[model samples]
Target: MKLCVIPARGGSKRIPRKNIKEFCGQPIIAYSIQAARKTGLFDHIVVSTDDDEIAEIARSYGAETPFRRPAEISDDHTGTNAVVKHAILWFQENGTPVDLVCCIYATAPFVQEDYLQLGHDKLIQSDKSFAFSVTSFPFPIQRALKITQNGGLSAFYPEFRSTRSQDLEDAYHDAGQFYWGSAKAFLQEHELFSNQSLPILLPRHLVQDIDTPEDWIRAEYMYKAIHSSI
Candidate 1:
């Protein structure tokens, strides 16, 4: 069985109630739920959250809230793997064993059904533990710099200071949109960045991390720009 679990806790530090915060017009979490629904790839689409309001909102978007997330795993320190594992365990105990699971972030407003479908197809055909969204870094990370004690800049890779940009290998980072994994992978909490994973590359324009107020504003502008063109 295929299951989609979206982890959205109530305690948000950067932007209060960010999970349900309005992006454009509707709540940001709504975008994720809508994308998951559009894919038509899950036996059950569950929103694993601790907040009552969040659960209600999730239900309105056509996701199941089978059980309230335990308080222990709903804190700031808790990771996405733990939350997905908890949901997997709950389904198993309730006699609903899932073979594949997808964890979509609540704040990922840029998530598209086509990419989610791509991740699903890739995971099903491969032995990888995960097939998650990733995007190439706009700037090469090899020439990165850091601030010194005296507030001066220094190259992180001094050896690559003179290297040509085209000569450097391209780098990519987690798009923070969605992750498709086998039930066993999530339960084992395997390293997502390891070789046992497949990456679904996305264009940089469609990816944005909305953690702070500034980030939210930037995301709003980006979202508007994309939708306007569409």
Candidate 2:
């Protein structure tokens, strides 16, 4: 069986109530739930959260809140792997045997259903433990800069300073949207960014990280630009 697990903790420090905060028109998490529902991929779409309001909102958007996440795993220090492992264990104990699972982020407003389907297709066909969203860096990461403690700038790789941008190897990063993996992979806490993971590349414009108010504004504009036609 395929399971969709969305991890939403209530202790966001940078942006308060970020998980359910409105973006564009509705709660940001609503988009994720809607995308999962639209794909018709998962046997059970569930949201694992610590807050009552989050659970209620998730259910309203057609996701199952089978259990409240434990406080130990709901803190800011908690990691995605721990939250996902908890959900997988819950299913195993409840007699629901899930073969494949996807951990969709609660704040991913730009998530696409087609990519989710694509990731699932890749995961099933390959021996990799994961197939998740990833996107190329707008500029090569090889020539990244850093600010020195002396208030001056320094190149992370000074050797690449004279190299042309096009000559630099292309780089990519986790879009922080969704992660699809086998139930065993989640339970075993396998790393998600290794050779064992398949990359489901997404257009960079569709990827946004909404951590602060400025990020929220940029995301709103980007969302309008792409979704205006729809």
In model 1, the clashing pairs are none
State every prediction's TM-score relative to the real structure: 0.99, 0.98
Cα lDDT tens digits, model 2, 60-156, are 9999999999999998789998998899889889998889999999989999999999999998999999999999999889888999999999999
* Candidate 2 residue 133 C-alpha distance from true site, Å: 0.6
Each candidate: what lDDT? 0.95, 0.92
Residue 4 accuracy (lDDT) in model 2: 92
Off by over 4 Å in 1: none
Candidate 1 lDDT over 148-207, as tens digits, reads 999999999999999999999999999999999999999988899999999999999999
Where does the lowest 10-residue lDDT sum fall in candidate 2? 184-193
